[model samples]
Target chain A: MPCKFCSEKPVIQLPNSERKLCKSCFIKYFERKAIRTINKYKLIEENDHVVIAVSGGKDSLSLLHLLKKYCQKRNNKIKLSVLQIDEGIKDYRDISIEDTKKFCKSFGIKLHIASYEKETGKTLDKIKKQHKKTIACSMCGVLRRYLLNKYSRKLKATKLATGHNLDDEAQSIIMNQFRHNIALSARLGPITGVKKDPRFIPRIKPFYFLTEKEVATYAYLHNLISKFNECPYCEESNRFFIRDMLNDVEAKYPGTKHSIVASFIEVLPLLKKKYKNQEINSCRLCKEPTSSEICSACKVKEKIKS
Target chain B: MPKIYLEKEDKILEVKELLVSDILKSLKINPTTVLITKNNELILDDVKLSKEDRISIIPVISGG
Candidate 1:
């Protein structure tokens, strides 16, 4: 099929619609969609320092590239930086970081690298070897998020951007529903967290509505990433199952993920309002904002130590 | 037969000519989770495979 807007051969079919878009047209559509999400949510404002959290994956690299393009076309007031958390997985992060470094160099952006080994005194691989009963994603998610927020704040960033897409958000919504975790759901959205705290750097998802396939296509077309490598520890997480389930549903019913996110966005305000009054406390160990006395990252560190 | 390269497994399969959708179905890979490329260029799901086609199935899902 030809592109919906042009005569060129279509490169991708929009997950929510029958419309197919060629490379050039899809790139514009993708960027415009992200811009709309940003503007509608006020994700980035003038004079704001935006630190993009990159994982050297397609989603992150595409986001970093998109923001670079957006910054070029918009006001010069918004500052851009890149942050990468090295979970210290052998053969996985090592390979992907090379891609990220090349991308940052080509784009002329400085890249900040933080590591679990540096801050927590143990690599994820070592921690996983020792804590055989603990899930890798559980520990990695907590520490990666901790470092992202901690370093973003240290960088004096006003907003931290991530590469999360519609599919990811949809998976989280379903995962939260399955686990009966409503408060976590409240923290899930384009702009995360129910309310702002001084130490918490607001995180934004520019590709909030775009599908994973769309981001992959964009990354492939631009060669933003050198390879498509899945984490060695992915299949152990609940998210992998949720991701497959959501993908199956999306295949059977087009726009299933989109519908999930759209509906969630509609009720997000209420979810926030309901959970906003909940007090935010600083983790006594790390001093990071958390709902409990000790943050999840510190807890994981304690487990590793034991 | 069309040659299909599975990016995740780093394996190639020589399979019967079929539509892009059928190829994914045969492999049990959801279309939403991957992209099909022909000769290093992206192709639509409706495209039919030909004997000369060298296709690559790129997995889009990344867990971190």
Candidate 2:
């Protein structure tokens, strides 16, 4: 099919919609949707310092590329930097970090790298070896998130942007529903965190409405990413199963993923309101914001050390 | 025969002429998780293949 806007050959047929767009038209649509999402949610503001959490993956790199383009196009006085957590997985993370560095350098965006070993005293590979009973992703997620927030706060960033897209959000909503984790579900949205403390940096998803395919296509078109690398520890997590299952259903049902996110967005405010009054505490070891005295990262660290 | 290249697996398969969707189905790959390119160009799922066609399946999903 020709592009919906022009006679050029089409590049992608947007899921859950009848419109197909060619290379140039699709780029415009993809960027426009992100700008609209950012403006609608007030994810970024003037003079705000935005720190992007990048993994050297398509989603993160695409977000980085789009934000740079967005800021330049509008001439917005937004300070942008990049933060990448080195989970210290051999072969997996090292290769991606190199690509991320090149990408950031191309745009002159300052890139900061943190490591699990330096901060937590062990690499993720070592932790996985010692804690055979625990899920690697869970452990990595906690530590990565902890470090992201910790460093973003240190950078004095007003917003932390992630490459989270519609598929990620849909999988998260379903995962939360499956586990009956309403409190965690409350934190799922385009812009995350319920009551932000000075220590906690609010997270935003600029690609909230786009699908993984669309993001991948955009990244490919712009040559923003080097390769598609799946984290070595990812396949063992609950998310991997849910992602495959969701993809299976989506193939058959077409718009299933979009519907999940759309419905979740409608109910997200109610979910957030229900849990807004929850208490936040500082971890005795690290003094980071958490629901309990000790944070999840600290808990994982103790597990590894024990 | 049509040839299918799986980028993630770094493997290739020789298959019968079929629609892109059916080829993915035979390989047990969810169409949602991949993009198909025909003769070095992107194509939609409904596109049919000929014996001379060379298709590449590029996986898009990356677990974060």
Candidate 3:
């Protein structure tokens, strides 16, 4: 059969004859593995609805494709809605939202688009206006997650799926270590925390094992994955520097990255026992579980003028 | 050029004796918008930079 994504002619001929995946098989494998991970983890419980944060990037597109494939195979009419949060950064998010819409439309997935301005009553530009010392990219990240959760909860979603892949996880581990943040680092794996509250929807990473290269390849073979390169505004992110630092180290040290994360996971049971002291209590203001008076999202939203 | 080291790569990059804002501008990052570590401390983007600094940037990582 022709490749499922692009209606491209055929994907039977591998450039390297010895390769196991024709271009199509290559793409399918990544999506299949993602599905396998989700199923294996039992991440999707019955009566659970999911809100996918589709960033119109390679990893997320592949993730959505796999989720659709999984739903098809299992004949589960699961309620999945793709939420595209536009950052209001000129063409960057616009292009991405368009691609996300196209992918969702092609698959018949229900979709919702929330622009920073429309949803928040303020644009990222406006947020930047208020906070001069802070970078716009920084606020965008915070707002996206905050809004994603708020919207997901309002929609009654039981969980959230993001397009974070293996490299993303590994990078986070190394960066956290480099920053001496063992506590936060420990929580950066496939399943974060299960705060089993009605208001909180746990997030799951289905692309946990797959590498960055695999995700990119899947998107390429699938074709037209909204070609927005790195954001012009976020290159200064210290994470990018850490990313550069980890590049050679990860390659030379082999499982060095994975082991760092694995070590954290290994110690999590003990770590929580030793360090996690109190039962999760509600934010003093919003009733969200937090170590502080207000949840991070609520605090950020407090910045937006009503 | 100030010798800002991104030692995780174990090599030094020649950065300027610049303010955090200029550096972020050069790096394409908007400041106060992401996490910045200098010599193991989270430094503000407004802090001045010198040759002897080791820096790493971690945006509030949200994956998985």
Candidate 4:
């Protein structure tokens, strides 16, 4: 097969790496795309440190790997760090953190792991008990995001990067729209970070244009990603079902992921215009950007206690 | 359309006794990862969805 990144002739697809690009343009094009994403979405400014929300998962790992390669290729001076949240999901958290640490160690990125138990004196399993039938990941997610923004700001970083790819974005858009969340779908387009607030550490998804299969295939081909499957605690997530359905759609439509991503660009501007009248205020507890008085993270924690 | 917590009208979710996968399928969303909740209850049903319920679906996120 021809190299996926370029149409240069006689390019061979290697079976042992995350990319199907020719060796010549691989680094250059990857860096260009990263830069393009930033420029396209205005994710980060030059000379700003970036903190990656590393999960040690395929998408996140792939994002980190490509970012490093891109940064080095561009000789960008932005400092990088890998931050991991310890949700204390028994065997799962332990293995995921170990893998993240190992990858960061080998790849030479600074790694930070904040345990949920350590921060709040409670683990996710314990927190789940506070709310009956509430999926554990929800509470953990809010905390992780809160911490990421907090720590990112504490570290004086300019932006936070995550590994949300095309499939992920699609699921969110559909879910939000189904529940009359047009504003949420409005915020679904590609970007390096959120534009609403500065204290919130704008988040960017460089892989917004990529698909889950491409990430997995890249991980599988390159021996890059961790061997673990999805976290066991995520069984309650609607994304799993959405994923299977999208895969079936892709099998029939071939390029659905790209189409969905493309659609976001078209819809995002209009959604923003429509929701421009909505009021946003800072979270009272954390002083971070939020529409609510107390951010969801703090509220969830308070719920856990009360 | 129940009393769902609307996160500024963006991250809408259906919190029912329905399976996470079923909701995703119904919504035509490709699942990456998400957090589900309903009225402070931890729902485990994958196929059952009740009406007049408050549900939340947060996108899969990871950070520290």
lDDT of 4 by residue, A157-252 (tens): 777898887778877777776688776675566653224666767778887765554454344334564334456677676666566676667646
**Model 1, global lDDT:** 0.89
Q: TM-scores for all candidates? A: 0.97, 0.97, 0.71, 0.72
Q: How would you order the candidates by DockQ, starting with the best?
A: 1, 2, 4, 3
DockQ of each: 0.79, 0.72, 0.02, 0.03
Which stretches in model 1 have alpha-carbon errors above 4 Å?
Answer: none
Q: How high is the CA lDDT of each candidate model?
A: 0.89, 0.89, 0.64, 0.64
Lowest summed lDDT window (length 10), candidate 2 chain A: A223-232
Tens digits of per-residue lDDT, candidate 1, A194-293, equal 9988788999999999989888889999986466677888778989888888888888888788889999999999999999999889899878888999
Which candidate do you rate higher for DockQ, 1 or 4?
1
10 residues in a row with least lDDT, candidate 4 chain A: A9-18
lDDT of 2 by residue, A236-302 (tens): 8899899989988998899999999999999989988999999999999989999998999888888
iRMSD, all candidates: 1.2, 1.5, 16.4, 14.6
Candidate 4 overall lDDT versus native: 0.64
Show model 2 residue runs off by greater than 4 Å.
none
Q: Write the per-residue lDDT of candidate 3 for residues A1-306, one digit (tens) a residue.
A: 343445443322221122334455566666677777787877776656888888877778877887777777667667788887877766666667777778899999989877777766776656766776666555676678767877888778888898887767777777777888776664556766533556657788998877655565565556634333455466646666766565456544555555655676676766545545535667786665565667665666777664
